[model samples]
Target chain A: MQSRVDATRCLSCRKGYASHAAGTCKECYEESNHKILDLETKVAFLQFSSSLDPSSSPCFSDVVLVASHDATDQTDLAPPVPIHAHKAVLANRSPVFRAMLENQMEEALSGTIKISDVSHDVLRAFVNYLYTAEACLDVKMARDLLEMAEKYQVEHLKAYCEKLIISKLNPGNPLNSFLSCVLASKHKAKNLLDAALSLIVDNMDKFVELEEYEELKKDHPQLVFEIYEAYHAKQVETAALKEKK
Target chain B: MQSRVDATRCLSCRKGYASHAAGTCKECYEESNHKILDLETKVAFLQFSSSLDPSSSPCFSDVVLVASHDATDQTDLAPPVPIHAHKAVLANRSPVFRAMLENQMEEALSGTIKISDVSHDVLRAFVNYLYTAEACLDVKMARDLLEMAEKYQVEHLKAYCEKLIISKLNPGNPLNSFLSCVLASKHKAKNLLDAALSLIVDNMDKFVELEEYEELKKDHPQLVFEIYEAYHAKQVETAALKEKK
Candidate 1:
């Protein structure tokens, strides 16, 4: 009887629970633990040490990327810093780079690929992510990287950025949500679009009064129409559910 | 009373249990599920698409690895097929490759690394593992790759191969265990050494009569002594436990 009573106690929390409060069977809990450990090991194996340090021996960098704006700044006496990287890594990570390099384009012939309208720091981070799929990102950095990732067709990095942006979206920050929606729609980020749209729809009274929303309506009226369409569909669904009840 | 009974049911197995049979509390189980999902996402993000296809556009391969035996066979009309790879990837994955390539060694200058005592298929798999961190291994393949992984100081691959080899280790096959012990000792694989030693110690009587054991005793007497020492220590520990009880 004592053993049976003990058996009802939760293995993880060590608290006694009735069947309704129980989380999992012993076998499933144990299996999940093993799966977590295995996944961690695999993640460790797959993660690469970022080849960002140029001074490190045997970097084997075959190409250099220079930010175009920085390069053309004639007033600056010091030359624009070039970010060194492997062509193979760039080609593997980005279809844009693959086509540019593989087709013997001007960038391929010159060995220096000039990226337009990007800062040197952002370019460095972008190249670093090519080698190591990691970036320390805040909202602005995520947005910056997302733009570059979208242009380069690095879907993994784009998805990562979108997730970060969506996490930061708040009901109180309708302007930010509106801007994120615009960015998501521009980049074909369906997940971010849906998240931002839902947030805006839930707080529509507050969202419509934002100055940014007025500007967005003038510039991207098609997007505003889509949002209205989504809002209407949600309303219809809620009314139908209420009727069913 | 019905609702209270329902609350104690296991969430995973969907069965009722007393307090002792519960695996985890609700909070821990939910957290574990979230952790598993996060880890799986991380693994997917970190995994690189292997750059192994030579004919693929923009492969950007700057170095080739040739199997030494295949290269020397003058009678064969077909030249030894070289494995295409990037020096950056090789350097990133292996300290040996880093040293060889970064120091402007002959192989670095020539862009052709001659790997001695490895077959073409094994060499190809090894390079693929460097890029993708994946390999399909049987016992024989695991042993072969383990040797290369040890030589190149690819700790991730070595650990992976050791894990596979250990999983395949069976007490019924004492000779296989003995050989694994020897290999582990030679390569300083502590985990494999411990597992193989435990298996051999547990079945010492059967292990002692094997012809491979006699050969191991003759050639590697120190390893045989270590195994005996472990067996004696285990026996002493077991006797002490019995005495205490």
Candidate 2:
């Protein structure tokens, strides 16, 4: 029970601190602690097993999703393994799956849905996210999942993949930036689109010399226009700020 | 920016507060915000729907839990409604369920698992907690669920119910306190048991005169001995403190 003039320990880390280093007062600290505890409990309640084994039936999956593209791989020609999952989980996470299942579509009756344009690994990762809402992303996996998320109307996955793409964004690697821009436009990922556009605009001189830029101009010319548009907008904004100064 | 000498407004609630009312430093505030966002995302990913519809198969429930006690309400001759649930979810939440289901027990073959003694409402709440880790609990429901959680060996749910029960404990209500003591002891809810026993000992004079105390003594004389033991122990401790003073 010291006076306000005396230094207090932080409620979070419990380290001694002056007023300037204060995180919160005792009242606020206790309130935030309770809120965090509540959130953690909710997370615990929501968590299901991450097991994807068909035999285990971790979430007791009623439907199985198979990657059709896996058939193209000559290494394992027998058949593509199916990913087991539940319709209710799919419906809760994605409206596309919900409608497909609820309507008793041909796929629902057959109990197997084939997903094309995705390898078995990517399909597995996508289905895993549907059940667990988690993914480990390399650049290619993130790109593929971002497109799939957009196609499936899974906004959470799309936003998550977009963040992953942005986190790996490198201005020095303009080819990566260029590819991200094309992917962003195709998926309508505003965050990724903005990030890639900014990188391309900032490194215009270096990026224009690359062969990928010429290919992008020939392939995705509309996406190139967006970069120019953002570049000019940024220039005008910077000039306006200078004039105000 | 104002100097440390001038009180800064809280970033959290955005209130004009003095230094004494500080919630957190700017660094900790931003960090906590990010932490909360991460936690919320995890919660979103973990959340499975709480639908008990058999046809809906919210988590693709393989087993149906029927409250056997509900059949004993002779006025309703019809069989009790079965609560649909996922074996994977039940197995993940309770080791008892996992062992039973995995070992190919009679209940596993039957597809309908009979849970005796609990009513339909309690069974539904119990299954709901398995999927969502949440229960709308009053004191009686909390006690019942706590016992059920203990029976199922679902420590998370048991701890959750114990916290709720303890949070709502009223020391003045000795009848509630006495019952909680017996209930807590039965379930081995150390926190609740300790709290209830402390309350009983503190209000010994008023509590002993209550008719419920006599009933508890007649029914569970062992519990009565525990009360006296705790009371004498607390008295000895108090006397020691007095001697030291």
Candidate 3:
């Protein structure tokens, strides 16, 4: 009989592992491979070549998204960006856009959908996500996009932005953490909300000392109450768990 | 220490096996599960709600597809079916459709893209596939769609059709098997070619006796040679493998 050394060869991993190592046998490997192939092909079939190119408009795009701030700006940052896109695509992704475009509204008739209170860069990224379902995210970009996503009711983009915001949350930036909690509450994001509440509860002493904490108490007094309520609930739950143990 | 039985639970399959049985040890299973979720979300993101309904033509559809034969038909079998769709959707899927629509040709100007030499049902299904990356396929439907897919240069659909055609290959239908080999060669479908060649080689005597064999030899002498050549090559390879063993 072959020893543990020979038994180490994993069909899936295609590497030698310990005899009790984490890997599938040939059957499971083959099954998963078939599944992966099917899914990859489906993804390929579903994917569209992004129709966001401005100079060469694909012509079929029925509507335009122009950044309100960029339209007024004379500086060479970026000109009044009239981002060409399909109303069908916008409508399909966001119910807000759908209601705006589908009911013979002014937006539909005018063919110029004005997105105010956002920079051209954020607006471009937002429109691109409507077609491609992808975005490059940083903390600031994620927060801006999360607000945009929440406004549009694009649950997918909101979730993607929330994930990025949650991943970036740390003790170094308690203000950002608190803001994330506010966004999580606004978007009703359970995962981000939990992470945010946990961060605030764990570092309660330093959390109140932050600059935004003072402003949040004044601007959003209800949020300050929520933080305490969440902290108390967690303490009670932990005490109950300790008693059972 | 856990016994072999206790250590046998598959995280994916959720069934216990012997310790030496086919499955991953937790880690690979979890990795694949995460991959599956990501892929499923991506697929969901890419999928479109077909904008094909006629009652409330949202007026966004730039072009339409009409069954050419149905338009010409005098009988009341069905009305001249004008399948409404978007030029962007058509172009996104097929280069042929893209070229015809994007070039401002007669079809583009007329806003009516006529699909000739296909039935109303087939044309409807084809347009539906352009919107949703899905189709209901039987053997006849698979063959018809494969031909359309090849014509349109939709590689994913062609591969899907080729897989279906190859899977249905059997000794009982030597002519169909031979035909699949011809399709495989024309389409450069390696998997279908090997499958078709094996079916022909495995039932060589019956293949020669079939009526289509005489027709194939008359119509395509080179294809007959290819079938024999493939059989000979497989025999040599099998002999070499046996010798190595």
Candidate 4:
């Protein structure tokens, strides 16, 4: 038995494993490797060059998007800069843009779309994503983009942002997780909400010790109740499993 | 050893492999599964809604392409129909289009580009491929698209067509393989050229018996010479290997 086990070799890592530690047969493993390669090739073929890059040449932009800032917001004194884009790209990426452009809306006739309450950088990134399906995201950028993606009904971008935020959720940081929970709920990001909820439920005692917990209980009592409900359900499930054992 | 081999169950198929037929350790298999999922998600995200689809709402097309027909070649009497598209998409996909549109060439200024010696269906497919890196390819369609892709410098589409053509290459059918070799050489499709050459070399005796071989020798003697050179090199390598044994 020991000799047979020793003779076994993992095709992936080229190492010996115990019989119980086997993952796949040779045929299945090779099939999976081929699947990965095919998928990677498809991804490379599908990825487009961004029209926003100046070096791409002849963007032939037919529409402009200006981030309309409030007069009272004294962030910058300069006039709002317009981002050049193609109506076709914008329409293809977002249903909101399609409606705005296709139905002879005021923005369509004017060839200038004034987007209210969004910063220049966020709007630029949003448009770039429509062109290339790519963005360099941080926490703030992800949150901002998530909101814009939700408003535009760009499901791909929204899911991308949700994945990023969910990956960043930490059970060790209760306050951050709580805030993410709030943001997810607001944006209707179900996956992000679930991840944040799981983190909070796992560390409920630490979460309640934070000063923000009292404020959250007072201000958004429904959200606090929901978290407690999830914790209760988890406890009940664990108790039932223990009883069965 | 028999009992231990039976104990080693594949995680994927849940079947036991002989000790030497083990593929991957549990950790590497799980990692590969995750990587495949990640790549699949990325491919989904990157794939855009093609502007050619009318149901996708507004296309906002800015340029038109008409497949020009030669008067001498009477395939169809219908006037050349125009395909609407975005200049930005065309330029982003093909450097040839970028140069033509960016340099304010005759086609760029006219808002209409005339493509000569291409069927309407082939031209439409080519334009659609620029927007969505996909095509339904048969032997004739693949050959036509490969020529266009090579002419327009669309490397992705070229590779796609080459892969399709190479997949259809058969050593059992020497005539088809010979034709594919000729086409690959004409288009400079390196992968297709290599695959077709390999098929032809493997069945050199069968290929020499074909009627097309005489015409090819008389017309493109250089290509025929290249095939003989490859066959000679392969024979030398085989002889050397046998001597070493």
Q: Is candidate 3 or candidate 4 better by TM-score?
A: 4
Residue by residue across A1-245, what tens digits does model 4's lDDT show? 23564556778888777766778888889999998988777776665565564334436889989888833354557777788888877877788998998898999999999988888889988988876667899989999999999999999899889989888888789889888888888989999989998999999999899977779899878778889999999999999999999
lDDT digits (tens) for residues A1-245 of candidate 3? 13556444444554554535555554676688788889888877766685586767755888999888875656766568688988877887888998998887989999999998998889988988877778888888888898899899998888888888888889767777788878888877878888987898888888888866677899878878989998899889999999999
DockQ for every model comes to 0.56, 0.39, 0.49, 0.61
> Please, what is the TM-score per model?
0.88, 0.86, 0.88, 0.90
Residue B96 in model 1: lDDT: 97
TM-score of 3: 0.88
Model 1: residues with Cα > 4 Å off, grouped in runs: A1-23, A50-58, A71-78, A211-213, B1-58, B71-78
Among these predictions, the greatest TM-score belongs to 4
For model 1 chain A, give the 10-residue run with minimal summed lDDT: A1-10
lDDT of 4: 0.83
Expressed as tens digits, the lDDT of each residue in A4-70 for candidate 2 is 4455545455444565554555466567767788887777656556578655654455788988878
Candidate 3 global Cα RMSD: 3.8
Across residues B72-191, which tens digit of lDDT does each residue of candidate 4 receive?
355456556678887877887888998999899999999899988888789988988876677898989999999999999999889899999998988889888878888899999999
- Residue ranges of candidate 4 with Cα displaced over 4 Å: A1-19, A25-31, A51-58, A70-76, B1-21, B50-58, B70-77
lDDT minimum window of 10 residues, candidate 1 chain B: B1-10
Q: Pairs clashing in candidate 3?
A: none
DockQ of 1: 0.56
